[model samples]
Structures are given as structure tokens and as C-alpha cells.
Target: MISVDGLGPTDYERADAARLTRLPQHDLLVMAGARFGDLAPWRHPEYLRAVAGLPEEQALAALFVLGRQVPEGSLPAPLLALLSHAKIVSVGSGLLSADYALVRLEGLTLLAAWRAAGREVGSYAPWVGTDTSTLCRLVAARRTARTALDLGCGTGALAMTAARNGARALAVDINPECLAATTFNAALNGLADRVAVRQADMAALDLGERFDLVISNPPFLPLRRGALGWLAGEGGPDGLDFVWAIVRQLPELLTERGEALVQFASFGDQRGPFCAAQLADELPGLGLSARMLLKPPTPPRWPAFAERDEQGNLAGDLGREYRAYVQSIGATHYHPCVLSLRPGDGGLTIGRYS
Candidate 1:
């Protein structure tokens, strides 16, 4: 048996490295079926056959089979598991390359398909899909948003929601492909005129204007020493670096009474109250007040191909250690929070705790 510890240097690094290595290169065409949950052979025989033949360690065969069989409407728990190990690759008609990210739409695999056949074919993900719906509901409940900005607007999900709710909107991202996709999604949803898409970074935007509501689902994962694909997920060593940066810049981007909704994970050692409290403490210096609309704890789970460390513990223990570190910094639990902020409200308030 491969003791989990023997496979690891650490969970994040191990998972990150596995993702990098497992990604199919140019010559190899890995077929993705449905979502990662569609793993049953009945749903994807070809993929299952391919998996059966490859060496088990060289390829995580079970995931390849199960991911393709998962149901359409439900979140693919198995696929999410695979993501902890393999970088998702999207394959479909007229496309045969890897994608930076993957989402599913009506049983079809949707991807930010940047490069195809040595050419850049516009990026795309299901903009109006379930994920969009969930995000839209969150923004619509905010009554104070007269003007809204969607930072890192991959496919204009939040921007469309803002427009639908009567807010003048601007959608921003660093990827031109993402900007184009946002435009396409906006037009498809019949909200094109109300939402404007632009290429800009959250930290370096120059809109020359502030908003009553600013929402972002920024990249918040910690990247390994030399790895890069979608920087959206990596949040630096403690996973709060990007969130801290955004919080610091938010006051200047908001109207005096403006509020912003930002989604972030409390990952690694940065898991609890320390992360929230630190934000609370820092916001005052930036001249802002914050209200956390949602904060839900998420316990650590096993990742695909996860291994163990020399300490006879799962490699993911490093993440737990980091979580503990964050707790010591004042964090209390592993909660994902959506914070609403206004200018100069010295302390952070919890609007809803789940």
C-alpha cells in the first residue's frame, strides 16, 4: 500500500504537482464526459476503456470513469475530488486542447477554451448556468446597489445579475478571452447594453469611477513555487494575500456609502476568525466598515491521489497546520465568507452565519 505520507511532500504541493503532471499535453487528447461525477462506465465507455488500460499510478482511472457519469443538475462530488489532483481538461466538438477551468452546461462540458488547434478560440464557461444563478440571487438581495462592478467577470454572471437588478454595471478581468466571453454571455442573456466588459486587474483597475456595489470572485488559491495556470485559485502562502489586497483597495473603489460583495475561501492556516478579524482590524485603516453576509465553515477533505508525509500523517495536514496558524492569527473556523463593506465602519459585522 502507498502510505499517504510516502506520496507527499505536502497536500497542496502534492495536489498541485499532480495536477500539473496529469494534464494532457498537445498530442494527447483526453476526453471529458459531462461533469466529473459522470464516472460510471455506462455513461462514458471510451473514457473508461482508456482508464482501464493505463497504469493506475500514471493515471487516476476511477476518476476518469466516474467523472463522466455524474448527473447534470447536481454538483459532481467525484469531479471536485479529481480537481484536487488533476487539472481539468475540456474536450468537445471542434476543440481538442486543455482548458484553464471547466464547468458544465446541460450535460455538455463548458470550458474557458483559450487555445484550440494552435489557435485561440474564444474562452467560454456556462455563464447562465447554476453557478450563475446562485451568485445572481446573492447580489439581487442587496437593495443599496445602484451602481455595481463585477471584478474578474469571467463570463458576466454577476454583471448580468446586477443589470437585471437595475444597477449600472461594469465587468472587469485580466484575460481578453474572458472579457470576450463575458460580452458573449451578456448578449446571450439580453443584458449586453447594460453591462460593459473590460480587461483589467482588480489591483490595477483605472475605471476613474467608484460604485455603490462592487462584487468579486477573485483568484484566491496559493500557487506552488513555480506553477501557473489559472491564478484565480491560488491565494499565496496563507490564501488571504489576494483578499487582503482587495480589501485594502476597496475603500477607494467604493462610493462613501458604497458596499462591496467579495467571495473568498479561508484556506490552509488562514481558516477562521483570525482571517475575518484581521480584515476587520485592517479595514479601519483603509477607511471602511464591513458586514459579513455569509460565513460557512468547510472542513478539510481528502484530495485525489493525496499522500502522507514523513510524520505519518496525511499530506493535507500541512493545510490543517496552516489553518491552525490562521486560527492563532485570530481565525476561528474554515468559513467561506461574502462580505459587504461600507466606508469607515471601524468594526466588521456578521450579517449571517451558516
Candidate 2:
């Protein structure tokens, strides 16, 4: 289903796998990263050589290169076709890398491309043993719902899992590219019909329906600006902008007995108890009752920034400013917490801060 002509492995005419065996690990990764840029041809041979001896990392890096070069929503078909024949083993987290023998097939999985470098690698999906996953499981265990909603479903990991466990689901995201990836994965797992993918901002969903359950791994990172990867990492100035909005809107979106499971990050630099507590305090005013299902301390770090400016100065100070802010927070770390909420009385009540 993927066009193999212009973008296939054969297109790297100058890259010889034999030469890749001689390049150092660092050089290979750098070259591979460069190959994703407009300078791809200039770096092709070097990338090929760097990736030669190292199949796993090479595959990872190549996929990363491809991700940067390819248009969003266009990656899945090619990747799926590539992974069709191989047996993929989980490398850890949601990462999957293939042996040289299985390279052709495994290279196509989005997980492989993501690990290659298209996306910053992290425990973004809560299903992979994150604080979010713990909360989702807890809610599912108690509620026993037949249908659920995964808000801001990045790769549809949570949505697919819910479907596998007998919950028909709707996975929503604002990024059409992400929805395409989710659709690819859903088809791969033969759950396409059960897990519907929709491209829509969570704040203004118009599904014309409500659910017995709703879950989200919303963008809670407090970034000053947005980037290409999952916005789930940028939660706005207080880092609670999206989370707070979601909490307030959830009660109305759920059935009287419906429940909501959400995950968010709280910065140590924040003024009072983290935003989770703030949400709890305000929940009552929104006619909601909520409790902390899981809260794990996540270290706070400097926000990621681009090196260039509007004037295109190579020597920008924005990166330094970001680092300085992180240091000033006295925050060597940050914490991510998961909360479960339900409809409650008219008056608000704040729970004990963690």
C-alpha cells in the first residue's frame, strides 16, 4: 500500500550496507539524523556506513530519518508494509527493534520509526507502565464499562488495549497524522472497527454522544510554545490549562454514573501544591468528585526550545533562558499524577495534597 519508488531503500543509491559497518556509532546516528534533512543526499553514504554494523540502532536511526522527511499521515502504510513479514519483539517500553534478519518487516512499525528518532523517546503512552496506565487499569477494574473514550489518543495504545479487553472505544486527537498512525495500528491488530479514530480537539468535541468512561493522556507539559511531536507534553504556563479545562468539562460529558481517568504532570516550581490539588479544589465547583488514583514524582526539566530566532540568529539565548528557568525552580525533578473523577454535589471540596 506504500509507494516504494521515490522513498524506498533503493532510493539511497549511494548508501552501501557494507560501508555502514565501518562508521562509528555516534557518526552514524548524526549522519542518519542529517539524512532526514534537505541535505539527505550529501549524508547518505555516511549514514549507510554508520548504520552497517549496527542493525538495531541503524534501523532505529533510519526510521527516524524517514519520519522527519515523510509527510505526517503518510508514514504508516510504508511502515506497515515493511513490518508485515517479521516477528517484532518488544525492546522495552513501547519500543520495538528488529534483528537484521527481520529488518525488512520490523522497520515499518511506527514504534520502530519512533525509536529511530522521528519522535522523542519517552514513556508518553501511559499503558507502558506509566502513572497514567496505573490509573486507567484501576478505573477499568472498578467500572467494568462496555465503552470508553481515549481523549488525545496519541498512538491509540490505550484505545487499542481497551478494545482488546472488551471495551469498544473512541480515540480522539487533534492531529490528523496521529489519527492515521492510530488507524494503521488498529488495522494491524484487527480492531479497526471497534476502535474509531477521530481528529478533533478535545476541548470542543462534538460527538453527539456521551460515554460511561473517558480516559486521557492530555498534553500537560508546561511549555511556552508548541512543537511537532505530541502536544501532550506541553500543558501551557501553569501546565494545568488543558487538564483543568478537561476536568471541568468531563462531568457534563459523562453519564451520571460515568467515570473519567486523566493523567497530568505537575511542576515542582509551581506555587502551592501541584496543579492536581488545584484541580481537586475546583472540581466541586464544577459539580465533580475526584480522587487521586496514582501520583508519581516526575523530574522537572528545562523546556525544549529551537535554536533559531525570527531574525535567524544562530546564537540565540532562548535556550539558555529556558535552562536558567529550570535551574531557578530548584526542581531537579517533576511529578506526573493520575486522577479519577465523577459527578458530585454542587459544593467544591479539596482533597489532601500529595
What Cα-based lDDT does every candidate model obtain?
0.53, 0.52
Model 2, 82-191: lDDT tens digits are 44322221233434433211111111112212322324443333112133334445544643667888888765666766776688899998765456556655554556
Which residue ranges in model 2 land beyond 4 Å of their true spot? 1-136, 139-143, 227-233, 269-272, 304-333, 346-354
Off by over 4 Å in 1: 1-134, 224-226, 267-271, 301-333, 351-354
**In the order shown, what is each candidate's alpha-carbon RMSD?**
14.4, 11.7
| TM-score, one value per model | 0.58, 0.58
lDDT of 1 by residue, 21-109 (tens): 34232112222222333212224455445545655322222222223322221223343333323334333452222333233222212
